[model samples]
Target chain A: MENFLQFNSVSYFYQTKDNEIQAVKDLTFSVNENQFASIVGPSGCGKTTILSLTAGLLTPSTGEILIGNEKVGKHDGKVGYMFQRDHLFEWRTIWQNITLGLEIQKKNKDPKKLARAEELLKKYDLYNFRNKKPRQLSGGMRQRVALIRTLMLEPQLLLLDEPFSALDFQTRLLVCDDVYDIIKREQKTALLVSHDISEALSMSDRIIVLSSRPACTKQVVDLSFEGKTPLLKREDKEFGRYFETIWRSLTNENQKTS
Target chain B: MAGILKPFGEVLPMKTKKQVNFSQAHKKYIKRLKQEKILVVFLQIFILALLLGLWELLAHFEVIDPFFFSSPSRVIKCIASLIAGGEIWMHMGISLAETVIGFIVATLLGAIIAILLWWSERARKVSQPYLVILNSLPKIALGPMIIFWVGSGFSATVVMCVLICIVITIISLLNAFTSCDQDKILLMQSMHASKFQILRKLILPNAIPEFVSVLKINVGMSWVGTVMGEYISSSAGLGYLINYGKSMLNLDLVMASIILLSILAGGMYFLVNLFEKRKQQ
Candidate 1:
């Protein structure tokens, strides 16, 4: 498989009034085309920074990030980001919110793109809620709406920054399955940043575990399950073994930091 | 459990056997709500009538000296005569024009300045302290200087209203623009949106509710500014009438001017509130 997104020794430093803080250091990883990859790390372990760097919102202080063998630059159109919060403009109805990117891109007049938006809404069982405001939707529905909004842009890569963390436990599990299904069905490459081991293990084709702040790759675990869906994969015989491996890797990093 | 199919294809839950009893209870709930509303209005009107009667009686008996206090009937008589003479119209019209013009100009100019500040980080940083100082300084103290600069006329009055309203507008609007969700902005950036696109699509829409609230605040601030300006230096206006009446010891005219001012201010507030409600809907 061809690597769709690559980070070559990427490092990021945040400059404050008093001192400089290194958030990411020598972080090297890659997500192949049509792959669901996740980067799991301890809290505040620069997981979000990695997503930001990949999305070209911030420049790597050292090393390079590439999408399809090209260097990532500011406001890369090939990348779509799904934030932890749905970030749906409450004032806008679901359909209007979904087309916000198209409006910004000046592609709102395109019939094809608008149809895709309509199709995604219907595909995700949100057709009935097309005219409702985001606040009127449940937590899981809002997350689905957020994903649909991102997918509307038709980017080559999707960057999800702890997209399920804001939801309740039950909603989180359901949304995780929903998102995994959507990403797989769309045949789009995805890089998820998460701290939940089960979440990453269930959805990701490969999981890259990171050390605490000044984040660097600690281990990269490739996953294979006979079950097709994330929920079904959660019940796989090897699920516990993968969980223990990722858990111990994370806990070891925590002990090292302390 | 099945539901009835409506003409519009909506599913209406079937009325259950036990639920039939709720119809009477619902009617009683609605009746109680209506009675409560009517009772509230009646009590409010009764309270106002009682207060006015007491005030009129007190003044007639010379218990509170009507010369200074001025009874409601005297105020009404003064208004009636002024209406007959038709001089109050000119004063009311001039004050209304100054206040409306000032309110509009201040809000637009302040919002524009806020946009400029939000667009540039350095501009916001440079103007932060100056804005704080200008916002805190007593604007009334600048009344004489404004008159000196713009002359003691309509221009000065309008300038006073703008001065009082603009700083608060700038501060509030700038805060609203800056405090917009950073992640939403990032989402826009991920779509490769330009700075102007982000502002137009996200920042401007996000700040609208705040702008409406600012307009509501300006309704009162504009009145204060216009009145203060007239007090400082004005040959015409409701404020001028009140000031002239004070100097002449015509308490009836002063009280009448105040009453007119209150009515106009209340009307303006009501219009703005109505506009806000429509926008919310």
Candidate 2:
């Protein structure tokens, strides 16, 4: 099957007054349609640069990125990005935040789009808090709201950048399950960037391990677990084995770079 | 008598002891809250009374010369006579009108100019040095030039108020606009939001707290600019009254005018506070 998203030899660099810092080099990967993929790497290993490139927030220094077989542009609406911070407009209520993209695109008045938003909010259990500001909700609920907001745009691909790293351990586990459930239930293609090996392993069907700064694709690991949710996946016997492999790949990459 | 009391208590035994205890605690909590509020009011009044009494006593004992210092009682008397004569109303109206006009116009114009600067990076770079220079210059130094340009009157006062307020508004708002979370802007960009849409949806909403702060500062600046304008040239205003009283050495009138000016400025500041409170809610 053709890839739903593709990075064709993508590379990125940050230019400064006196120096240029290569963030990613010759990185290439793809996520099949409706597949949950994750990119895991060492801290500051330019994992986020990959997401930014995919979202077309930054152009690749060389090579190209494609979504749904079409090239991505600087302001393409085909991609939805969830940042580390919830990034919900504090001044706007949950409902307003959800519809922000639609409002910008001038599709907010469409009945079908509004109904889809309402349906998503209801499905995610955020319908009741629709009128409340983002701050009033707990961290997990806020992330859910953020996810729902991005989902409202109905992007072809969702890029989650450490979406639950800000939550406490327990909340992170629950949010990971919730976010994974939403993405799967919606049958949407997703590409996640995480430093947590277990998080990447449990949530992703396929994982791309990246090397340290000037990151390149170190290895690609495909995961399958009998358990359904991320929480239950931790109990799967294969979970430990998959964790070890990804951990070793990451550490080995770190050792070589250091 | 003990048997009768026991039977009476037994008649009300349907109410649980826990319920009675909870009700008692709730009542005490409410009463304490009320008492705290009353204490705050009482302390405020007490402070004012003590300060005024000290001023009156000092003047009475000639520790501070009453002629120059003007005791609180004399200031009150002066105010009472002015009210009775009804001439102070015209001056108060003139100053209030000028200040209000200046405040509103300056705030709106400042916000628009800030938006313009934020919209264009080249424009912002070009205007940066000029804005810094203007903010640092004493606005009052432009008084003579303003009068020459606009002719001394309410318009000139408003121009002065704008001069005092607009630069600070631009600087603070530009800072706020620039400092809005870059990630949020990127999120909007990924949604294909236009620059103007991003400004409307993200930057402006993000700048609200800063905007409220700017308004609060402008309230004082507006008053300063208006009073300074009146000082330079005004036929009637509290500032004019103060200047006129000083010429005649009628310190009581000068003290009364100062008191009125403070009250008016305080009232304007309170209104801005009310706006902020509403926004927060």
Compared with the true structure, all predictions reach lDDT values of: 0.91, 0.89
Give the number of the best model, judged by lDDT: 1
Q: List TM-score (chain A only) for every prediction.
A: 0.97, 0.97
Q: Estimate, for each residue in B1-281, the C-alpha lDDT of model 2 and write its tens digit.
A: 23322311223212223544457779999899999999999999999999999999999999999999999999999999999999999999999999999999989998999999999999999999999999999999999999999999778888998899989988999999999888999888888889999999899989999999999999999999999999998888999999999999999999999999999999999999999999999
Worst 10 residues of 2 chain A by lDDT: A132-141
Where in model 1 is the C-alpha error above 4 Å? B1-28
Question: What's model 1's lDDT at B146?
Answer: 94
B1-281: candidate 1 lDDT, tens digit per residue: 12112111322232224644568779999899999999999999999999889989999998999999999999999999999999899999999999999999999999999999999999999999999999999999998899889999799999999999999999999999999998988888888889999899899999999999999999999999999999999999999999999999999999999999999999999999899899777
The positional error of residue A16 in candidate 2, measured at the CA in angstroms, is 1.7
Question: For this target, which candidate reaches the highest DockQ against the unseen true structure?
Answer: 1
Ten residues in sequence with the least summed lDDT for candidate 1 chain B: B1-10
